[model samples]
Target chain A: MLARPAAEKGLNNYMNDMFAFDETDRKIVEQLRRNGRATNQQIAESLNLIASTVSTRIRRMEEAGMLRVVAVSDFAVHGYHILIHLAVQVSGRPALEVAEDLAVFPEVFAAHLVTGSYEISLLLTLRDIDELPPLITGTFAKVPGIKSMTPAVGLDIVRYALDTGPVDSRSAA
Target chain B: MSRPELDDLDRQLIGILAQDARVSNRKIASDLGVNEGTVRGRIKRLQQEKLIAFTALTGMKLEKAANIAFMAIQADTAHVRRIARDIADIPLVKAVMIMLGPFNVMATCLYHDLDDLHRLASGRILEVEGVTHVETSLVVKTVKISNRVVRITDADTLSQG
Candidate 1:
């Protein structure tokens, strides 16, 4: 009985350490979001802080595994026109193992282990629609735990961003 | 295509940027064995074309802490685009996609918790005109989230067809 409370306390502490970011850290993150290629000096100039301070904050964020600077290219521009969201159900083995397997494919952009109608979900970027069948039959067929795979071909993607945005009470009314 | 096509040099620049968006132009130019002017010109063109963007992506740690849901909706097919736009405007919606499979509209949203997800899914999502059905699945774990997943192949082949 004592172990359970101690475990809960530890978990809470862990989460607090993981997500804790002050105002300055958040500001630096916002600046980086605006221009990921911005140099430390440029960010410092824009934020009105020393370059070393900006660099240190960024380095701290990087070390904490909270952020990364990456190039986001339009899939259609690079010839991978078809974007399909896959809902996969796993049964025979551990879902995490199967998800890890799915992540190895180059076409897969995001893979998540979830609960509901499906056990795993994936965002697959195919060069063309023709590549879908081969991928479904050849690659996915070999995975041991997959029970079903449902594909939703993206016709139009309206918004894709990281910002969660503020809570809008209008929705509740 | 309305956008300008990428040439070999453009592809090379994009490929380099895709690896490390923060890499300096001088470094990229030296790595690609091209003049700085050429690299700068191609990067400017790519940015103007909206073909490539540099941004910070939230890692899986933050995603895991948040309540991420995959919400699929079936609305009147005619108003699917309009509904998509409305849903996109809703707070916490990370992505909204009009799909062509079992569901007409699919979205990924972040919520403060299960209660927050319940409010959005049961409230605004259901109240939307023409929306007939809604299915929401809470994400339990994120295995991978990457922006640079596409492999760069032959530039000519990628440019054509």
Candidate 2:
């Protein structure tokens, strides 16, 4: 039907808007990545642009929900020496609702509604290994809709960055 | 321990930065009723201790990610670390963690489609020397992605995100 092409065009437009940054914008983002605390004036000096322009571009990116400048706390900072990846299979309720419930826990850093073998996935930070039992049996057990879970404790953080990185293929082989 | 290693002032400063990393150092110093030197010193000490960092988080483009998978792999223990590092080099593999549970190695990846995911798993991951097995689960929706889901003890600050 004609409706399909129209819907496709709308989706394409939405995608285009999200990644509409030009060469200057990309360079600005690269500069931020190199040093997040760099001031707008510093960035403008390096990029050879106006300070206000750099500020405007960063603000625009933040407003569009595409980027943010935030403080990143190390796991050890809060006594969370253990990082856990849990695959959860949901039952008796919608996965999204359960995921939202899981997200409320301060220990959960990232919670996603997923498919294939599991219905949900969680990345949690824990202070100690001893806290695992109490968390699994006491706290998580009380939460409804969780059927089963398989947890993997991180032995080493090979790589972990919240940023998705640059849009270009430079990072690739 | 029941409490985190922070005093009230540290908690407040951290909370403010958690909300906005780029808040002027002067502003933070003024709000915290401390001098600019004190604020700068605290941040420097914290970074030296590897407690916190300031950075920009670029969100994954909605359209670019047609499939996101958490791939769990079993690798020989001796080479787990090396294998994990190798996997991290792969562009699509965003994160790699050497674990000590049901799976020995885990990777988070963003790909264009199921076929792309398949190619990475089969063509690339399977080719690794130490890898024994691989399992993947595709993400259907992102419930929450936040850098500030920290529980700052003693201050009673638990982020809603």
Candidate 3:
């Protein structure tokens, strides 16, 4: 149900025109979104399709870089005492470089370049609030082309989803 | 919530659906090289066994609802369970966990404003019988949130084993 026109014509054309997914492929993607480690046999059975077909489609999708299945944990239960989101505004270096560097930090779970006042937003986890000052002052602020940062600690997470939404299988039809 | 002993095939099926829940049985059957009927039957059994359950994700669109805070609570041993239950009943609380270390209970709460948050932290939370200390931090924004458990690629790779 979530649809956005690709920012570039080449990638968009390649995905939409060159690589059009069939209903079965979309369904396969859906199944994987629900459980990344789903076996091809299991996926095929769920969709009432041949297992070989499911396997082939999954292989194709993986090569395309459209999806990846990985493990994730809730930091709150894992002894992560301090959770915070940093809204960073950059002035000099390429935003992507800053984002890539931030992503490498073990405490950083995720980072993104977004529109509006901030150029990048980072999600971080730590063992205690005391650990935060050193992380920001020593690492984040030291990144070249640095500008300003607004840190918002996460008090609670109400809801979140990994997949944007169900694949529009109807599009294939 | 019945924990059924899943076979390899069952694990495969669960993995696929865990990533994409809307996949059709026909498509899934094709991919796994199994009969559609078998896929259907297995899914039915999985659901019946209570190994799998489904819930839609909601409230991603941010609203100007209230200020949110995270609080770590330490309580006397005898009063821990009772206090946990009481905090869970508070409607504004979104998530709570019983943790180890200095803080025994960790919780997330939402309020209409700072005053509401202050009232709960000072009045209700502090008033609890066995509470020794409370550390609170306010959340400004959320970058990512997810409940999906990561897939264990290799059992042999597990350190515990």
Candidate 4:
């Protein structure tokens, strides 16, 4: 328990120090979030900065593993119809192990080793609502050390954004 | 909803753009054995169809020393949708969904630390009118996070393979 948080803090400290992701980077990212195709000249013009600085910062952030501009596909518009959240209780095995094992499945979108009543939390995408039954009973039942699973099928997804925050002093809590 | 299938060239273009959305269309066109106009036109059509979006997705843990959490909520059955929307509007919440099963509503949120997560669950989410029970879980480790909802048609499926 003590070791993980300490390791996390140390790693985060290194990351924060390794890259100075400041106000300018945030502004730059905001612009890109709005339009990823925006030219460096355009971003520089909008932000009132030198085009070289815009280019330099973007290159720096991307190289340092601090940013990624990805082309994301829509979920519902394609064939995937159902999304479910599952709170899993584990016994006899480390939660991370199970979480990692579960991660390989294409349907498991996000798997987390968690702290609470349940040991692991999962987000799943499915072809149809009916997939839930066979998945829970037939598939998940086969995985070792899964004591029980409490699942909630998403009837309507109000929001599905994952790139949450680079929360700092200005945006903390 | 019926939609046109993405051809091999289309998927290949998308794959390159997926890696670097900022890549020049001219660069992509040359690599794909097509003209810059063709590349631009396809990207425009894909965007207009709402099939793809270009955005900067942040690495939260590295970016802000933030953590992720999920809140499972029990809400008034009649007003579940309303309550879910309310939770969605709150800060820190990345996603919210009205659900069916043991809990009626679920949310995924990011926090600077456990305190922020605790505050979000008890202070923000619970205070919503229709919420009854709110069970919060803090993510200790993130195994995977993805949103690969791409559709593969039979044409590209065989050709690409």
Candidate 5:
């Protein structure tokens, strides 16, 4: 209880110290977010910065681990028809251990050790609804932990993003 | 939705781009021991197919010093879809997933500070119409977050291996 908030604060401090981004960096990131394959010249033209500057800023930000330009694939288009959120309540075993174990499965898109009713929460992409039972009974059986699990099948994903912010703060930048 | 399968070359290109989206076509082609024309052509085809998208993904935790909250909402079933969209429009809500289970709506929200999260929960999220129950779980740590399959198991098997 005491440790979690403390850790959050420590994270804030670390981010402030090492990960702070200026206006230019934020704008570059925004442009890239719109189009990851955007060339430096294009970004510079759009942002009214020099091409060299854009490239330099990108390199700096990448080194700082503040941003990543990646290819995002749509699971639904590829026949992964079902996406489920699982909240697992752990009894005796550690929650992080369980999360790490579940992380190995290819279906798991994201896993988190959370603070609330459930210990470990997961976002899984499955081929079909039929895969659910075997995945839990067979795959999860290998993971040693005794507790309850709740599965929520996603009907419509209204909004899902791998990275959520900088909050359209190009004005500030 | 019928789509063309990604061959070995396509998967290799995607895997490489996933690591560094800004890598040049020439560089990638050289690394993969393929011609630049083939690499360039495949990337264009991949984009046209909408199988993959190159975008900027910020590490919110590191960039904003933010705390992400996972909120589960119990809402009236009749207006579930509308309610989910409304909540998604609210500031700081990154994801709003309409679900079938105990909770009808779920969202992953980001807050710059704890006060923002408090205001969101007590001030806005709870006040939304038809929202009967709002359960939030603060993400203490993110163990894994990947948008696509980091490892392509069997290109032939749609199961993602």
Candidate 6:
């Protein structure tokens, strides 16, 4: 597990301190869940409200730092055939610095400071198996303060989602 | 596509929907303490504005399948699109994208093993016109994967202001 960053402590505290949501907020969110790209007009029609009012609500939600919209590609359709996950252990530098360095690599899809034997976890895409040796021996090992690395390739993705379903009312109860 | 304007309420709504995509409009209205009609209106507007999009998430664990490889190709700028389209037609190719920096094209494919990967790279991928270089990385493991974007909603706001 990676050690939690000091800045994260403040962010986590803030999240915990946040209050609950009311009904309209929940409805707006549900519509977004179904289609992040759904038009404001369509949402208005679905929920039956004026366009500008819906726009205001969306603006408010954005200001609160709840969610975002982005283009998502099916990597499978692309030429990247190999997906490699690397759990890297670092010794000298701060984990965040290492994460920043790893992020510079275009092949690296995602990097996280996680909790476990490793300090950083990386998601990467590559063209073939031959590229692995160079990445491990050349790119990663060269990073200062890097101690060790463990990699786990995904064999099958059973179930995964960007968002964990709505906060259960039962959990609050 | 351009990013959209969003406020605090919009952020809250997105967060809620991110958690559960299936919640009803009535339920959402009830949770946010607003008229159901109002909730419905906002959702339509967000969709029309292209602020968010939804698609089924599908993934396969390549390690268990016995074959996996990453194919990087360098192609002439003019022909990159054509090459990408050709590669996409292959059955084993799972994903393809244009990248920045050293490489021009990055693709992921699934196969039986080393022999299978070799055949695809040499025969199918390399065969594409204008492909200058091909580099393959056999995935060892997957550490983390998520389609979520950071600051997608607010990053634009800060920039605009």
lDDT of 4 by residue, B50-95 (tens): 6677777665634463677788889999998889878977876767
Off by over 4 Å in 6: A1-173, B58-68, B85-95, B110-120, B149-161
Each model's lDDT? 0.70, 0.71, 0.56, 0.73, 0.73, 0.55
Report residue B94 deviation for candidate 1 (angstroms): 1.4
* TM-score of model 4 vs. true structure: 0.82
Candidate 3 Cα outliers beyond 4 Å, as residue runs: A1-17, A35-42, A76-78, A164-173, B1-161
User: Which has the better DockQ: candidate 4, or candidate 6?
Assistant: 4
**Candidate 1, DockQ score (0 to 1):** 0.36
Give the worst 10-residue stretch by lDDT in candidate 3 chain A: A164-173
4 or 5: which has the higher TM-score?
4
Question: Taking the tens digit of each residue's C-alpha lDDT, what string does model 4 give over A38-128?
Answer: 9999999999987877887777677656677766566634556777888889999888888888888877877888888889889898887
TM-score (C-alpha, index-matched) for candidate 1: 0.79
| Model 1, span A1-173: residue lDDT tens | 01124554355445745555656666777676667788999988877888877876666556555666666565556576778999898997999999999899978878888878899989987777888888899988998999998988898767665432211111100
Output the lDDT of residue B114, model 6: 69
Summed over model 1, clashes come to 0
- Specify the CAPRI tier of model 2: acceptable
In model 4, where do residues sit more than 4 Å from their true spots? A1-17, A129-134, A164-173, B1-7, B147-161
Docking quality of model 5: it rates as acceptable
Cα lDDT, model 2, residue B86: 82
**Candidates, DockQ:** 0.36, 0.38, 0.07, 0.38, 0.39, 0.05
Winning model by TM-score? 4
Q: Looking at candidate 6, what is the lDDT of residue B54?
A: 48
lDDT of 3 by residue, A28-110 (tens): 66565455446778877888887767765555544444433432222322355566666678887887787777777777865
User: Per-residue lDDT of B1-161 in model 1, one digit per residue for the tens?
Assistant: 13447687777777777655778889988988998998888887776666666666554444433667889899899989999878877777767789988999998887777777888898878788888999988788877664343222222111101
Runs of candidate 1 with Cα error greater than 4 angstroms are: A1-19, A162-173, B1-4, B60-65, B148-161
lDDT of 6 at B119: 83
Model 5, residue A38: distance off in Å is 1.5
